[model samples]
Target: MNITISTFMKIAVTVIVISALLFSVGYQMVVDESNHYDSELDRYKNESLGR
Candidate 1:
């Protein structure tokens, strides 16, 4: 079993790309959900809306 430098580099790059993509997607989802919750809370607290 012989692994060349090219093959190792390709595998490493692929893993890094996939990891970055997954992290970005997950981070975005969390941020979006937090923003939505914050907006909803703000709307609920608005006293002018009681008019």
Candidate 2:
């Protein structure tokens, strides 16, 4: 019923790895969306600014 140090370490490591992977995927998704939005905004800027 009680967890040992090794067991706790293993669970902690697993949780960390899973969290990092999920964060990486979510971060990249936001980055991609931002990049897309920037390009679109640039197009509008160029058309309006006559640059």
List pairs with backbone clashes in candidate 2.
Answer: none
Candidate 1 segments whose C-alpha is farther than 4 A from its true place: 1-3, 47-51
List the global CA lDDT of all models: 0.91, 0.96
- Find the candidate with the highest TM-score and give its number: 2
| Top model number, lDDT | 2
Q: What local lDDT does model 2 show for residue 14?
A: 100
Which ten contiguous residues of candidate 2 have the minimum total lDDT? Answer: 1-10
Residue 2 displacement (Å), model 1: 9.4
lDDT digits (tens) for residues 1-51 of candidate 2: 356888999999999999999999999999999999999999999999999
TM-score of each: 0.77, 0.78
RMSD of each: 2.8, 2.4
lDDT (Cα, tens digit) per residue for candidate 1, span 1-51: 256888988999999999999999999999999999998888887855882
> Looking at model 1, which ten-residue stretch has the lowest summed lDDT?
42-51
